[model samples]
Target chain A: MESRPTRRRFMEWFLGLGTGLLAVFYGGASALALWPPAPTSAKLQDMGPVSAFPTGKPTFAVYTAGGAQDGVFVVSQTSGPPTVFDFHCTHLQCAIQWSSGASEFFCPCHGSTFNIDGAVTGGPAPRPLHRHFAEVRNGHVWVGGLSS
Target chain B: MSRQQGPDESRRPSHLSWPEWWAERLGLGASWREALYHPVPRRSSVFDLLGFMTALAFLNQVVTGIILMTFYSPSVAGAYQSILAIDAVPAEHFVRDLHYWGANAMVVLVGLHLLRVFYVGAYKRPREFQWVSGALLLAVTIGFAFTGYLLPWDQQAYWATTVGTAMASYFPGIGSFLQGLARGGDTVSGATLGRFFTVHVLVLPLLLLALLGLHLLLVFVHGQSKVEEALPEGYRAKHRTGDHSDFPAGDFQPFWPNTVATMLGSALVLVAVLVALAATHPAPLLQQADPLNRANYQPTPAWYFLWIYQLLKLFPGRLDILGIVGLPLLSGFFLIALPFIDRNPSTQRRKRPFALAAGAAAMVFVLGFSYVGSSSAVGPTAAATTASSQAIAHPSFAHNVEPLLTASCQQCHSASSHSGGLVVVSYADLMKGGGLGPVIRAGDPADSLIIQALNGTSQQVTQMPLGGQQLPQSDIQLLSNWIAEGAPDN
Candidate 1:
C-alpha cells in the first residue's frame, strides 16, 4: 500500500512540473511575437550634379529606386554643399512648393513655411524641412534621403 | 460571605467592576483580548515585510504627487516652463528624482509582493478578496504612471502621451471615447494635460486609497494564512489518519513590535534604493517644446506601458480597429472580473492553471511589445544617392519648364487636372490657358501667366497654391533667368 501511494505521488509531481515548464516556454514565445526591432537604412538613388541644379534656384526632382517613385524633393544650393529637402511638410507630409519671390518652401496644404535651407521660417511646420545628406562624388552630386 | 464580597468588589478597579462597565468603557470582551494578545508561531520572517513596504510606497506617491501639483501647470505654453521651474527649486531636483525612482520602486515591490503571495498560496480561501483588491491596486499604480507621463510637455512627453492615448483608443466601442477622454479633444494638447492631471491627482489616488484600506482591513480580520508545508509520506499518512489537523494556525508576531519593525526596515531599504537610483541616474532633461518643430522627436512611453504601445503598432491599418481597441478592452474587462471568473477554492500556482496562464501571457506580451516598439523608433537610414553628371550635361526639355511650373504654380494648378479648368501640362497648353487666359505669353515670360503666378498677382479666385509654399530667392532667380534666356526648351 505504501509503494502504490509513492508511485502516484511521483506521477503527480512529474505532471505538474511538466505543465509549469510548458507554460513558461509558451508565454515567452508569445511575448517575442509582439515586439520587433527597428530598421536601420533606407535606400536612395543618385539624381545629378550641383551645376546641373544651378545656384540660387530650386529644382524639383522625382526620387526613384529599383523602378519605383518613393518620394519627390526640391534640390537647391545656397553657399555650402547642395542640399535636398523633401517637398512634404513635416506636419502632415504634404508636398510643398517653392515660391521664388518669397525665397521659402511653402506647404499649401497647411500653410507651413520653410526657408531656403529647409529651416522653419513661419506657420505650422513642426521642424525644419527634413534635410537629407548630400555628397559630391566624381563631379556628380548625390543626396541621401535618410534622416540622421 | 457578605464581608468577603464587599472587600473583593472594593479591591477591583471601578472600570472593570461589572460586565456592563467592562463592555462599555474598556470596549473589549475577555475573549477578544485573549485573541489580540495571543502568542503566534515562530515562522514569520523579514521577507513577509514586503506587504507593509508596499503600502508605504503608495503613501509616498500621494505625498510627492501633492508637492508636484503645487507648481505644475497644465497649459501647453506653460507646462514645459513649469517643470523647469520645479526643477530649479531648492532640493527640487533631488525630490523629483526621488519621486521618479520611488514610483518605479513601487512597481517592483508590488510585483514582488504578488509573487510572494502566489508562491505561498496566500490568495486561497478567505484571503481571496485581498488578492483581488491587490491586483486592482497594481492596475491603478500603472494608471498613475501613465497619467503622470504627459506632465513635462517636452518632446518626449508629448510624443509618449500621443502614443499612449492612441493605445487607449484601441478599446472596442469605447476606443474613440477613451481617446477623446484622454486628450480632452480630438488631438493631444493642453486639454489632455489638464484631464490627466485631474485623474493622476484626484481620481486614481482616491480609488487606490479606498482599495488599500480594504486590503489592510482584510489582512487584520483574517490574519496571515499558513504557509503550505512539503509533507512527506509519513506526515501525509498521519494527516489522513486524523493525527494532524489539515489547517494549521498561521504563525505570526503581534502587529506592534515584530511586524512593525519588519515594515520599517523594508521602508528604509526602499528609501536607500531610491536614493541610490536618483544619485546614479537622474531623469534626463529634454529640449523645450516648440510648436513649429517636430523633426527629431523620439517619443517613447513609460516602461510599464511600452509593451501595449508596441503591441498596437504591430497591426496594420486594415486590422487596427480591432487590434488596437477590441482586444485590450476585453482583457481589461476580464481583469476587472477576474474574482468572479476564478471561483476555485485553490489558489496554489500549480492548481490555478487559468490564472497562471493569464499572468504568464501578460508578462510575455509586455516584453515582446517593448522590444518591437523600441526597435521601430530608430527608423531606417538612407543609402547615398549620387547625382549623375550625364543628366546635367544633356539637360532634357522637361527640366527647363518643369521647375518654373512646379515651383511657381503647382500648388493651385495641378498638371493632371487643372484647378479652375486650367491645365498646364505642356508649354503649348500653358500658353493656351484656361478661364483666366494664357499661362505664358510666348517669349514674354514677364507679362505671362508664369510671372503672374510667381508674384501672387493672379485674379483667378485665389493666390497660387492659395496660402503658402513661398518661393526661395534662388528659385525665383531661376525662374527669371529661364524667362530672360528666351524661355529655352533645350
Candidate 2:
C-alpha cells in the first residue's frame, strides 16, 4: 500500500545494513588474526635442576610459555653469578650454539659471536643477545623470556 | 514500402526496424558512427607512447596495491608480518613484485619522457601548463616513493624516514610544520604509518589522476610543438607554389592501430624488465624492529632522496636548512617554470645552460648521496664513546652530564630507551660498555676506557657508532680526565 520509492528506500537501507555488518565481521576477524593478544608477561617455567647446567660451562635450555619456545642459553661462571641469554642472535633470528673451544656462542648463519655475558664479541651482530630474567625459586631455576 | 517491405525494412530483424530499435534503446540512430570517426589532428609519435604506458602502470599499481592493502597492517608491530603473509599468499608475490618494479619503472620512464619533451621543444606556447603539470607529477611520483618507504616498518624504513623527516625540518619557518605533517606527529610511529598509507593509497592517487587528466587534455589540445628548423630560401618559394594548410593529414596515421601498437610495445618491454628484476633480484627484507634495540640501525633514504640527504650532511648544522629544503625547493620551482621563464626559442639540452646544469647537479647529487648515506652508520661513535667516558669520569656532575651525553652522544653510545645498542646511560652500563668493549678500564685511569675509545684501540669488532658527528675539544678533554681517574663507576 506504500509508495514505490518508500518501499525501494526500505530495501536499500536493509541491504546497506547487511553489507556493513558483513564488512565489520570480516575486517575484525582479519585484524584479530594478524595481531593476536600476546601476553605482557610470560611466566618462567622450572627449567630442570641446578646441576643440569654445570659450573664454568654453558648449557642450552628450552622453555615454553603459552606453547611457544623461548630458547635460553645459560653460562655458569666458576666464581661469579650465572648469566642467561636468549639463543637468538641480534643480527637475524638464527639460533646460536655454544662453542667451548671458541669460548663464545657462535651463530653460523652470519658469524656473529656472543661472549659469556651475552654481549656481542665478534662479527656482524648489532647488539648483545637479550638477557632472560631469572630467579632461584624453591631450589629450582626459573627464567622469564620477555618482560611486561 | 506500399507494395511490400522495402529492402532496408526487409533486411532488418522482424522484431524491430533499424532506426526504431536503435532510437528506442540507445536514444540515437545509425548516424552516431559518422561522429565517432570524425578526424582529429595527429601530432603524437612513438615518444608519446611512454605517457600511455605510465597510465597503464599506475592502473596495475592500483589493483595490486588494493589487494596488498587487504592484508597490510599499518602498525609498527604488524607491518612486517603482513609483508611475510603477502609473500606466503599464492601468486601474491608476483603481484607485489610487479607493483614494486612498476613503480620504479614509472619513475624512470617519466624522467625520460620529460627529457624528450624538453629536447623537442614541446613546452612552448600553449603547452607550458602541461610542462608544469608534468613537473608536479614527478614530485608526486617521488612523494609516492617516500610514503611507500615506511610501510614495511623495519629499522631501515624507520631510520630512512627519520633522516627524511629531519631534512623536511630545514624548510625555514614552515620546515617544522612540514616535518610534523609528514610524520603525522612529532616522531615516526603508528600515526605516521597510517597517514603515509592513506596518502599513498588514497590522497596522492586522487591528485595524480586529476593532474594526469589535465596534462593529457592540454597535450591533445595543443599539438606537440615542433623543433625549430632553419628554412632554405627555396623552401618559402616552394610553399608559395603549393597550397598552404594549417591542418595536414597526409603524414599522419589513424590513432587506433599505430598508437595502440606503440603503447603496447613499450608496455611489453617494461613488463619484461620488471619480470627480470623480480626473477633475479628479489627485494631484501631486514630484521624486525625492536623498540628496545637499535644497535645496527642504518638510516638510508630512498634512492631519489639520497642526494638531498648527502647534501644536508655536507653542509654544517647551521646551513642544514638551506641545503636540505631551500635549494631543493628552488631547483624544483625552476625546473617547473623552465618552459615559461626561458624566453629562448631553442629546446636543445646543450643550448639550455641553466636547465642542463640543474639536471646534472640533481643526478650527481642524488647518486652521490645515496651511495654515502647507505654506507654510513647512524651516528658518530667516537663522540658518543668520549661523552660516555666523560660522564662516567665525572659522576659528581652526573645530572649535568646526562643531558649533554644524551643530546650529543645518545645516537651511538646510549641504550637509554631505544637510542642504540650500547648502554652508556648509567655508570654500570658504561663500565659494561657496548660492542666496542668496556668504556671503563677499572683502577687504571691513565690506561682507562676513554683513552681506548678515543684511539679506537679496542680489539672488539667494529668501533662505536662508526660514522656521524665528531667530538668537540671540551668533550674529548672530559673523556680524558674520566679515563685518567681510572674510569670510576661513581
Candidate 3:
C-alpha cells in the first residue's frame, strides 16, 4: 500500500473519484426533483377588516394576489367577519354591480344576479358567487388566498 | 473483416459448446440462438430504427403498465385510491409518467412508421397486409388510449369517456351497438369501468400483440422494400437504372452487433428522457368522478383526438350528423384506401407532386385542427378570465332562493296544481308571474307579485299559503329580500 503509485494507478483513482462524484450528483438532483417535493404553501395577500365595510351594501375592493388584480366583494351584514366573494358574476364573469334599492349583485354582460350572501338568484348562473378566504383574527377580518 | 468468419473453421466451438451439448441431450437442435438472433445483414436504416423505436415504445408501455397494474384497482371505488397510493410510492410517478408519455410516444412512433412506409411505397401490391395490419394496430393503439383513460376514474376521465362513447352512438346502424359495447350500457357506470379495464388490460394488448407479430413477420418476409423497388416499372427504367454504390449492401453490417447496439442506446436515451419528464412534470390526477355533478367538469379528449373534437365544434346542430359520423368515416376510409388509390408507385418524392401535396396538406390540416381544438374557445362567448386557466370550481348553490321557494311555495303552486297560469316548479315559472301578471321583476323582487301576494297586499290576488298557516314574518321578509337580490338561479 505504501509503494509508489504508477501513472495508470493514479489515473484509475482519479477516474473512479470522478465517476463516484457524478453518480452522487445525479442521484441527488433526481431525488430533489422527483421525490415528492415539499408540500407547497399558497401565495397569499392580506386584505384588511370587515368593519371597514358598510352594512347591507357590498364594498368592492381590488384583490391583487400573484400580481393579478380583480374586484372582490365584501358584504358585512351583522359583522364579525364579512362574507368575501369574487366580485365577478358566477355566470359570465362580468364585474358585478350591487344595487342598493334592489338588494342584489347584477352582471351587466348578462342579466345574472346574486344575493347579498353570494347565492346565484337569477339569470343563467349555475352556481353561487365564488367566495374568498376571510376569517376574523385579532379583532380584524383578514382575507387571503382562494386556493393552494 | 467479414462478420461471418469463425475463430477457426477446423476447430469450431459449435461441436463442444454447452448449448450444443444441452441441445443434443434434450433431443433438440442447436439452432435456437440463430433462429432468434441471426444477423440482419447490417443494412438497417432510419426506417428500420423507426420501426424498432415504435416497438421499444410499446415494450416500455407494457413494462410500466404492468407495474402500474400491480398497484391499480379497476373498480370505480378503488381506482382513484390506488392511483393515490401508487403516487405516494417513491419513483412510482416516474413509472406512471413513463407509461403516460410512452403511450403518446407509441402513437407518434407508429404514425412515423406508417408515414415512412407510405413514402417508401412499402405498402405496395405485395406488402398490402403490412399496411392494413399496421393501420389496425394504430386503431388498437388509440383504442388502448381510449380504454386506459377511464381507468383513473377522475372527473376528466369520466366525462371524456362519456362524450367519446356518446359519439360512437352517432354511426348509422351499428352506432348504438358500438356505444353499448364500449359503455356496457346507455351511460358510464361501474360496468363501463369494468369493461374499459378489461379491454385496456386484456383485449387491446392481445390484439396489438397479434397484429404486431403479423406485422413483424410480413416485414421480415418482405425484407424492407427499397425506394427504387417501390417505384413504378417505367419510372424505375428511366431514372435509376443501376444500384448506387451508396446502397447499404456495399458496407453490409450485421444486425446482431451494430444495429442492436444502436437500438439499445436509443432505447436507453428514450427512457432517460421519459425519466426526466416524469421527474419534472408528473402526470396529474384530478378529483375522483362525481357522476351527479357531470356538468361541473369540462371534458376534453387526449391530444391525438383533439382534431375531431375541434371539428365537432365547427359542425353544430344538424351539421353534427356529418361531423360525428361522416367526416371520421371518410378520413378513415381514405387512410385505409391510400395504397390502392394512389397506384402511381414512384417512391421518389420529386416525381410524385400531387400525392406529396395531398399528404402534406392533410398533415398540416390535422395539426392545425389539433392546435385549435386543445386551445379553442369552449363557448361562443368566454365566461371567466380564470376559466381557461384552471378547473372551474362549482359555486355554492346550497343557499339559492330555490330552496326557500321549494319549501314554502311549491306545495300549493306546484306544477300539478297551480293557482293560476303560474307554477312554482322552476325559477323561470316563478319569474313568469301568475295568470295575473309577472310576479318577480329580477332585480326588483320587492315589487314582484309573489311578494305582494305573500304579504296579502295585492288587491286582486288572494293571500298565498291560503289553506296553510300564515308564513312567519321573518320568512316573508327573507322571501322579499331574496326576490330583491336579483333572484339568482343558484
Candidate 4:
C-alpha cells in the first residue's frame, strides 16, 4: 500500500533537515575560525652594521621596531657571511648563553650545548639550533623569520 | 470563570491572580514542585551532600568569573596592566581573590564528590551513564583550570602555559596540530590568550551546562543511592527495569526538607571557607611575562596537577609520553569502565575488598607524588644559589662591572652607536647618563637608571640589552653592588 505523506510528517522532516544544515554550517564555521591562521610574511628587522659584529665571536644584535623588541646572535665568521642564530634554545625555548671560554652556546635553563655552527653538542636539546633568514646587505645585518 | 478556588486565593480577586496565570503559561512549576517533593532515603548522611556542594561551588565560580570578565582585557599588551588595575582597588581585588579561590574549591569539591560516589559503589548497573558523565565533568573542570590560568598574563602564566602546550605537542600523531590549535600559533601570544578567554568564558560553560543538565536529570530520575549494606538481597534483579520507586520505601522522607536543609548548610560553609581564604591570602599576580627570561622563572602546574608534574620528572625525555599521555588515558579509561570491570553486583565494601584496596593505593600514590612535586626544584635553582652566594662584597667598577657591561650592553650603548643616547663604554660616559637620565647615582643602586633598565622594572625605559636575554642575576648584582659601594674607579 502506497502511503500519503501527512502535514505532520512533512513538517517533522523539514525541521530535521533544517537542524542538520544548521549544525553542519555552525560546525564548519567554527572550525574555520578557530584553526590557526597562516603566518603572514615577516618584515626584515635591521640589527646594526657589519662592523659591529667581530669575527668568530657571537654578539647579541637586538632590533626594536614599533616598540616591540626581538634579538638574535650574529656570529660573524672570519671569511664567510655571518650566520644569525635565534635567541631561544631549541630544548625548551630559554635564552642561550655564549661562553668566550668554551666558545659554545649554553642554555642556562636546562644545560643544552650548541657549537658555533648551531649544532647541538650535548644535553637534552632535541635538534640543532634554529637559524634566522639573515643577510649582510649594504653593510648592515637584516634578519627575517626563522628558517623552516 | 472563578476556577481557581483555593482558600489562599479567596482573599484576593481571583481573575487577576498573577502567579497562577504565569504558572499556567510557563508550565514548568508543576514538574519543579514534583522534583522538589520527591522522596529520599531517610538516613541520607552528610556524604550525600557532596554532589549538591559541588554544584554550589560551580555556581560560585560562574558568578565570580562573570565579575572578573568585566575588568579583564584579553589582549597581551593590556592584560597585565588591567590585572594590576584590578588588584589596585581593594573591592575588585577581593572579587578576583574570591574567583581564584573559587576555582580551587570547585576542583576539590568535584574530586570529593567523585570519590564519595566511587566508595559507595553508587556507579553500578543502572547508574553507569551517570558515572561516565561525572568523569567528563571532571575533565571539563580541569579544562576550566588550564584555560583560566593563562588569563593573568604574568610570567608564571606564560611560561607555565608554554611548558604545558609543549607537553601537549608530545602526543603521538596529531601532537603538532593540537599544539598549534591550543596556542593559535607557533607560540603562546595574544592569539593564544584570545583563544583561552573564549573557551573559558563561552564554549566550556555551554558544554558544562549541557552535561550538568543531563547529569542532574539522571540523578533526579534515579534518586540517591542506598548505603552499600542497605541494599536488599535481590536488589539488582528486582530493580533491573525501574520497578522499584527510587529506593526501598522503608523510612524514606521527602527530599525537600530532608536533603535541602543539609545542602543549604553545606553551601553556607563553602561560602565561609572561600571568604576566609580570600580575605587572609589574596591571589598572587607575578611580574608581566618576559619570554626572554625563561631562564629566571620556574613554571609549576596548579596543585591538582602536581602529581602529573612529578610523574613527568619520573619519566623523562622519550618516556615523557608515559606521564603526559599514557597515565591520563589509563585513568580516564579506568574511571569510565569501572562499573563494567567490577561486575560483582554486591555493593558492600567487604565483598569488594581488592577493588577498594587498589583504590586506596592509588590515592596514596597521588598524595605522595603531589607532596614531592610541590617541593621539587625544576628550574635553574643551582644558578640562583651561586649568584646569591657570590654577590661580590666589594664589586669593582673597573674590573667587575665594566667588563660585564662591555660584553653585554656596550654593543648598542657605546660611544659610536649610542642607541639610547646612553654610553657605557667608559666610567665617565656612564655617569653622564643617556636619553633617559643619569644612568647611575653614587650610592643608590635601587634608584639608579642602570639597575632599573637591567632588571626591566622601569616603566619609562625599555629593558636594557633591548631585545636580548636579560643579564644574568650575578652580572646585574655585580653592577648594583658596585653602584652601592659608591661608584669609584678601583
Candidate 5:
C-alpha cells in the first residue's frame, strides 16, 4: 500500500493543483489575445491635380496607405464630381483593372465586367463594384474611407 | 559514498573503508542505503540505460540553463543582445553550445526511455503513476524546447514560431482561441517574446523540477519494474498479487557500484560526444525578427517538430485541426491511459506483439515524416515565389523612381531627411504629397509635382539644385515618361 498512490484525497488535491495552474496560464493568454483591436490612423489619399486625370477618359488612379494597396477609377466625364469606384471586384475579391478599349472595369481572375457607373455588366458578378468616398477639392482628387 | 579520509583530504586511509569509518559513525547509514537503494534485475543491460541517460541529460540541461540565466535578459530589445553578449565571453565559448546540445540530447533520450518503458509493458498495474508522471515529464521537456526555441529572437526563431503558432490556430472549436492564448496577442510581438522567455527560463524550469521530482520519487518507490515476468496469457488473472520479495533473492544485485558505474560511464560518453559536436559545429544566428520583412524568409520548425509539420502538410487546409490538435492529443491520452486499458503484465515481446509493433510503427512514422519535411521545399516558399513572379509582371517603383530619386532627390527627400515634407523613399510616401502638394500625377507630366519642381516654377523655394548642377533634361524626360504611364507599382 505504501508503494502505491494510497493517499486518495491527497492525489485528488495534487491533480487539482496541476489542472488549476495550467488553466490559469493558458486562460490569461487567451484573454490578452482577445483584447480590442488597435486603432489605425490612415490619412486620406490626395491622388493628384485635376488636370492629371484626362476629363473625357476613364483615368485609373492607384494609391497605397499603410502598406495596403487600393485603387479607384476617377471618371470626370461629366460636369459633376469624379465617380470613384473601389478597385476590388464584386466577384472573388481580386483587384479590378480598367479596359480602355472595352470602356469597362474587369476582374483579372474571373472576368467579371462592370460599367463605368459600377453596375455589373456581364460574367458571374452578382452586384456592382464597391465605391469609396471621393471628392474633388483645390484642383486635386481626394479619395478617403470605404463605402462598401 | 564516504566522508572520512587521511591527512590528505583527497586520499582515504587504507585501514578505513566506507562501511567501517563512515557507516559506524553515521549509524543510520545501513538503513539509509536500504531506504534509497534497490536491487537491479538480473536481466538488466544497456537497454535499461535510457532512464539513466535521460536523467543525466536533464542534469546537463539544468546546469547549463542556470549558467545561461545569469546573463540572459527577458526583454525583447535585450534578447538578441544578451545571446551575443553570452557568445562574446572570453575563452569559455562552449557554454551556449552545451545548453543547445543538452536540450537535443534530452529530447532524444526521453523519447528512447519512453519507448523502452512501453515495449516492456512497464506501465501495467502498480506502476501506473510512474508511467503517468513519465508522460507528463515528457511533455514538460518538450515545453522547455518549444519556449527555448524563441529565445534568440533571430530569423529562425521568429519565423519558425510564427509558422508554429499559426499551425496551433487550426484546432477545432477553440482553434483560434488557443492560438490567441499561445501568441499572447494577435501576432508575435514584444509581449510574446517576453512571455516565452519567462516560460523558458522560469515557468518551464519550475514545472520541470516539480515533475522530475515526482518522476524520481515514483521510480524509487515502485522500484525498477521486473521486465522478466510474462503471464501465460496476455490478460490479467483475478486474485493475483504483486509481491517484489517473491523473486529469487540471488537473481538481483545490490545497486551500489554496479548501476552507479553504468550511469557515470554513460554520462561521460554523452558529454564527450556533445562537446566534440559543439566544438566543431556551433549553433546559428540569423537576422533579427522583423514582421514586415518576412517575404524573404522560409520558416521551418525544429527537427523534433518536423513530424507534426509534415502531418499538417499531409492533410487538407480545412482538416488541419485533425492533424494539429487531434492526433497528438489522442496519442498522449492513449499513452496516459494505457495502464488502465492494457492491464496485461506481459513483458514478453511475443505475447505483447501489438504493443511492440505499435511502438515500432510510431518510431518509423515519425522518422519518415521528418525525412519528408526536411527534404521538401521550405514552407510558404512556393507561394512566395508565385507572388514575386506576379509582382515582376507590373511596373516597378524600384526600377523607375529609385534611380532618379536616389541620385537627384534622396539627398533631401528621405525618411530621415524629409525636406519640404516630401519623402520619395516609398511610393506610399511619394503619393502623400509635400509641404505644398502631392508629388507625381499619373498620366500627366505637365501637372506632376516632381516634374514641376524640377522645372523650377514652385512658390516655396528653388528646386533646380540650390547649389549643385541641375538634373539633365533627358533625366527629367524619363521621370515624366514614368508618370505619364499611370505610375503602376510592380
Candidate 6:
C-alpha cells in the first residue's frame, strides 16, 4: 500500500515537471521569434553636386537614405565642407523651415528655432538639430545615415 | 456519463423529433433545456440585456467579416485596391459599413455591461473569475478593432497604425519586441498587414469565443447577483453545494421566455440602429498610404483610443512611458484587483460609495479627454514656406529639375535601374514613357504622372519614393512648375 501511493506521487511529480518545462520552452521560443534583430546601418546616397548649392546660403535638399525620405538644409560655407542639418526639429520631429533674414531654422509646429549652425536657439527643442554623414566625393555631395 | 433520470426526462416521447433526436444522441437535450430555462432574478430589466446586445453585435460582425473575407486581400499591394473594388459594389459596401458600425456598437455595449456588473457587485465571491474573464473578453474585443483597422491600408489606416505601434515600442525592456511582433518587422510593410489579418480573423475570435463561454457559464453557475440585500452568513457553503434557494419564493423567473425575449428585443433595436448608421454613413476610405506625407498629415487614433492619445500629449519625451504603459498597467491592475480590494459583501450601491465615486471619476476623465481629442483638427498643419528671394521666369532642366531627379528620382528611375520602365537619367528618357504610358504630358502638371506621383495625388500608383517620406512641398511644387514649362530638354 505504501509503495503504490509513493509511485502515484512520483508519477504526478513527473507529469507536472514535464508540463512546466514544455510551457517554458514554448514561451521562450515565441519571445525569441518576436524580438527584433540588430539593425543594419544605412548606405550613402549621392545627393547631387556641391557646386549646385549657393555659397553662404541654407539651401534645402531632399534625398532617400536607408529607404526613408530625409529633407536636409545644407548651409554652404564660404570655405571648408558645408554644414548639413536634418530638417526636423529636435523637440517633436516637425519639418523645420529656413529663414535667411532671421538666419535661423524655425519649427513652425512649436516655434522652436535653431541657428544656421544647427544649435538650438529658442523654444522647446531639447537638443541641436540632427545631422547627416556628409562628404564631398568627386564633386558630388554624398549623404549617409543620421548622426546625432 | 449515466445518471438518475429526472421527472422531465422520464416523460419523453417514444419517437424523437429531428432536433430532439440529435440532441438526445449528443446527450445535450436535458442540459440544454436546463440551461435555457434556468431561473434568473425577477428584478432583471433592460439594463441587464447589455451582455446579450454585445453578443449580438459580435455575431453580426462575424457574419459580415466572413463575407468580406471572400473578397478581401490581406496584402499591402492589394488591400487598398480590394477595398476600392468592394466599394464599387453597393451590397458589399453596405455589408462593410455594417461591420464597421457593428464594431463600435459592440465596444459601447461591453462598456455598459461591465458598468452594470461592477455597480451591482456581481464580481463577489464565486463570481470573481467571471469578472476576470469578462475583462479578458473586453481586451479581446479591443484587439479585434485594432487589427481590423489596418486591413484597409489607406492613409488613415497606415499612419494611425504607425503611431500606435510606435507608442507600443516605448515600454522599458520589451518595447522593441512588442513593435516587432505587432508590425512583423522594422516597418509597417506587407508583413504587418498579414500579421494583423491573421490575428483579427482567426486568433482573436477563437480566444473571444472561449472566454465568452467561460464567462456565460459562470454567470449561470453563480446565478445573477441579488442587488436588494447582502448575502446571509453560511451563504458561501450553501453556494458551494449548488443550493441557490436564497431568493424569495416569487422573485425568480425562467430565463427562456421572460429574459430571452427582452434580451433579443434589445438586440433587435441595436441592429436597427447599426443599419441606420451604416446606411447614412458608409465607411470612408482615404488616399493610398504615402509614407513621405508624415510631416504633412496628422495621424489620429480611432475614436475609442482618443483619450489615450490626448493623455500622451500631456507627457513630454521619455516620460511618455507614463502615459503609454504605466497608466494602462495601473488601471488594468486596479480593475483586476477590485474584488480583492473591496471585500464588502453588500450589493447595495450606497454601501459602495468609494468604489462608485472612483469609477465615476474615471469615466468622466475618459469622456472629457475624448471630447478634447476629437475636437482637435487633423491633417497638414505644417506651416507654409518663406518665399524664395529670387524668382526665375522658368525652371531650368539642367540647373534645377535634372539635379532634383538625380537626387530623389534617379535612385529608382535611372537608365540602369529604371524601376517602372521609366528612366530619369536624361530629359529624352524621361519624356519617353514607362510601361503604363508617358509619365509627363507637356504643359499639364495636373495630368502628368510624375507630378501626381510626387504630390501623392495619383490614383494609378502608390505615393512616389516608396519609403514613408515625401519630397519637401517646395520641391514637389518646383517639379510641377518644371513640367508646366513643357518639360524642356534644354
Compute DockQ for each candidate against the true complex: 0.04, 0.02, 0.01, 0.27, 0.05, 0.12
- Top-TM-score structure, candidate number: 4
Alpha-carbon DockQ of candidate 1: 0.04
CA lDDT for candidate 2: 0.62
The docking category that best describes candidate 4 is acceptable
lDDT of 2 by residue, B1-490 (tens): 4687578864547787565566557865433322222223355556767667677777768887888888888886699999888888647777778778878877877877887777666787768899999999988988888888778777667656665665666667876567666765544667678878888999899999999989977755553454112322343233333323321355443334554566678788877888888766666556675322223232435555555655655554254456766788888998899887878666676677876676677667667777775444223343343223222245332643344454445656655453334666666766776544555675564465454544456454333335532233234445555555565444
Instruction: Give per-residue CA lDDT, model 6, range B128-230, as digits (tens).
Output: 9989898888889999999999999987787678767766777789877888778776556677898899999999999999999998898766666662232
The sequence of per-residue lDDT tens digits that candidate 3 reaches over residues B1-490 is 6678665853535657765566666765534343333334444466667888888899998999999999999887799999989889877877888888888888888899888787766787778888888888888988998888888888778767877786776777887677766666444667689888988999899999999999988866554576334333443223233322232443344445766788888888777877777788788788797553212333456889888876765654445658778998888888787778888867677888888788889889889999887666333133222231221122212353555466557767888888787787876787777788888876674578777777677787877767543443334445555555676666
Candidate 4, B233-324: lDDT as tens digits:
56534454434455557776555786688778889999999999999999999889865553455455788888887776665445657777
Give the per-residue Cα lDDT of candidate 3 at B322: 82
Give Cα distance to truth, residue B157, candidate 1, Å. 1.5
- Number of the top lDDT candidate: 4
Q: Please list the residue runs of candidate 1 whose C-alpha ends up more than 4 Å from where it truly belongs after superposition.
A: A1-148, B1-41, B44-47, B227-252, B290-293, B347-358, B368-490
Best by DockQ: 4
**Model 4 steric clash pairs:** none
Clashes of each: 36, 2, 9, 0, 1, 5
Residues A22-101, model 4: lDDT tens digits? 99999999899889655322757778888998887788766442233445788887775689887767755656766543
Model 4 ranges with Cα > 4 A deviation: A1-21, A39-43, A55-58, A61-71, A88-117, A120-123, B1-34, B38-45, B227-253, B378-406, B409-469, B473-490
- Estimate TM-scores for all models: 0.53, 0.53, 0.55, 0.75, 0.59, 0.70
Chain A TM-scores, one per candidate? 0.65, 0.75, 0.64, 0.77, 0.69, 0.75
Deviation in angstroms for B235 in model 6? 12
Error of 1 at B453 (Å): 34
Candidate 5 ranges beyond 4 A from true positions: A1-148, B1-31, B35-37, B41-43, B90-92, B227-252, B377-490
For model 6 the TM-score comes to: 0.70
**Per-residue lDDT over B18-79 for candidate 5, one digit per residue giving the tens place of the 0 to 100 score:** 65466557775444454333456555667788988888888888888888888888767898
Looking at model 5, the pairs that clash are B395-B490
